[model samples]
Target: MDPFDSSDDSDDDIFFRMMYHYYTTDLLQPDPTSLLTRCAMLNRNREEGHKHLYRDYFADNCVYGAKDFKRRFRLSRDVFLRIANALESRYKFFQLRYDARDRREFTTLQKCAAAIRLMAMGESPDTMDDYMRMSERTARESLYTLSRGVVEAFGDVYLRKPSSHALQELYVVHEERHGFPGMIGSIYCTH
Candidate 1:
């Protein structure tokens, strides 16, 4: 076991041997057919879900009014519509489409609603399946797509860095509101 002896296997050789053994013998490789097996598709009736959502929130004489919409979504219905519309116009993913079987997919509002629900309520993707008639994967995709869409669509105005005057105003406002002079934000510790 001498360090400089060229007789024994080197550390790299030992590591590669271990890796090769693990891959060849220890690892349980999955079957290609098993990889092709998918979950059973459920007829969640996405069209019906769309109609219900429209009747409850967007349609005239709908079940829920503007106040209810605002309370639930943390944004006024008009503002939500504006964002949804902007995203739909900007991102093709937000547009309604038909599947290969000619089955209508979820509407733009449904996808946006799933994304907003995830943001507003801090819910997981599975929670949207029952309400939005979308699969968990779809709900997760909607969240990501909506986030990217919003940043691309409205990042210039909403996510821009503040000007010097704006920062000064924010500092003054923070001081007046919290009685902490010149405190704009927490550095590390978050409440």
Candidate 2:
């Protein structure tokens, strides 16, 4: 593993070594995949996939304490870590401004996702917890963490970094047959 051993190394080896230098944590994420598409590469069968994922994939400490989670939801190691990092950066200001320590549980990712779904469904924190099987406090906290100013307060210069992604237009239609808030449109359409 010489620093000057460029003769026998591939690009990936160098990339991983550079990544390791900064990230001391041994958490290399699994591939994050979309929910809708069931492609061979993306969709691993639950039975076989779960077994394989649980075996030697996690970096020694990546368990979420949600009983019956296999039946309740689907998430890979990569997504979980990504969400954790996102939440940490998202509310770094609020955390530091008040000298609050991070409650960086595996549930943080799930909590954020649940928060968005609850907001979209017009459900309050406590109500969302009942369906989500999450305690009320955790749900409330994640929602409170997603603040733009909080990130800047932590000295990130910007809340959200500018993207080079080319903008695209979306066409959405609504009809009266649908119920309340039936005429909402999102440019990104993630929700």
Candidate 3:
């Protein structure tokens, strides 16, 4: 009947032993936040590389120009700028800053372009470094932050369910084109 006695093989004794082990062993481990934060510091030394890749190449009309920029980035420069502006205004992490060493960090333009390219092309983050002049880790972080920022900033307007009027218009267009009144869309089922 004693609670501290380990001789008993009851379920309660087993539960207590497991709980005690978890608390004393796993819960007492040192915090890993510092290590993770240190590793997360962005490599601002790549500023020159980023400028060369983005400004000198992508934005230069004599090189990639507006058409090539649109094709490669999957967005027009104006649209890209608008999205980057929204992200920068809404998310502090997307804003460029100076590191402790007074080195300039990646610009909002670079982060947005990298993230948009990854999403649009579905390429591995490793492949982005050569063209984007960003580390793979930085590219991944940019994608993560940009995606979440976009969802938070523009999800209400872009990702919401269609309104009834919109749905009705879509139904009318589909019916006229396909000759089916009730058919909303086509589905391909595979076994």
Candidate 4:
């Protein structure tokens, strides 16, 4: 019968309890932004990105050939696909997935390409949005994920120091290619 008493299942008492809880908990919490600004979910057409990438580099009858792919990406398409496939298999993040809104996320190719473009072109993360249709944050994350994946997957094969014999062979090859008998690095002319 009392308006303030929570013992009875009354609307007024319930409101009071909610207000008290809100003041004690949520009200005390600091607001991150002074302005009532919230980030809106951008509709970056990820599917188109994937499709364009595929058409340009991955498809059987892709617009670009192996030479162009290598020229633009700084690697052969075969090697790129190998790295991408490896990352997708090893990392859950690289795998195709759906968001809470049931929207399909970026494909493995898109993510890998984003990362590779950033590395190869030395471009900013936001630059990928124009062609890749991914947000800057996503592009940045993709770069990091791809780097870690490549290091983990192909570290031993590609990242390890050259063995004595391998080093000797490399010296020979460099000498042959550049006509420099004992060139260790990319010094063109020491004259």
Off by over 4 Å in 2: 1-83, 89-106, 148-191
Ranking by TM-score: 4, 1, 3, 2
Q: Candidate 1 lDDT (Cα, whole model)?
A: 0.86
Question: Which digits, one per residue and each the tens of the lDDT, describe model 4 over residues 54-121?
Answer: 89888889899999988888998889999999999999989999998899999999999889999998
Better of 3 and 4 by lDDT: 4
Assess candidate 2 and give its lDDT. 0.46
lDDT of 3 by residue, 7-90 (tens): 748888778877787786666786877656555565435677666667644554446677777887788878888889999998
| Per-candidate RMSD, Å | 8.7, 23.1, 9.4, 14.9
Q: How do the predictions measure up, each by TM-score?
A: 0.71, 0.30, 0.63, 0.76
Which has the higher lDDT value, candidate number 2 or candidate number 3? Answer: 3
Where model 4 places Cα greater than 4 Å from the true spot, the runs are: 1-38, 185-191
Deviation (Å) of 174 in candidate 4: 1.1
lDDT (0 to 1) per candidate? 0.86, 0.46, 0.78, 0.87
In model 1, how large is the Cα lDDT of residue 100?
80
* TM-score winner between candidates 2 and 4: 4
Task: Answer with 1 or 2, whichever has the higher lDDT.
Answer: 1
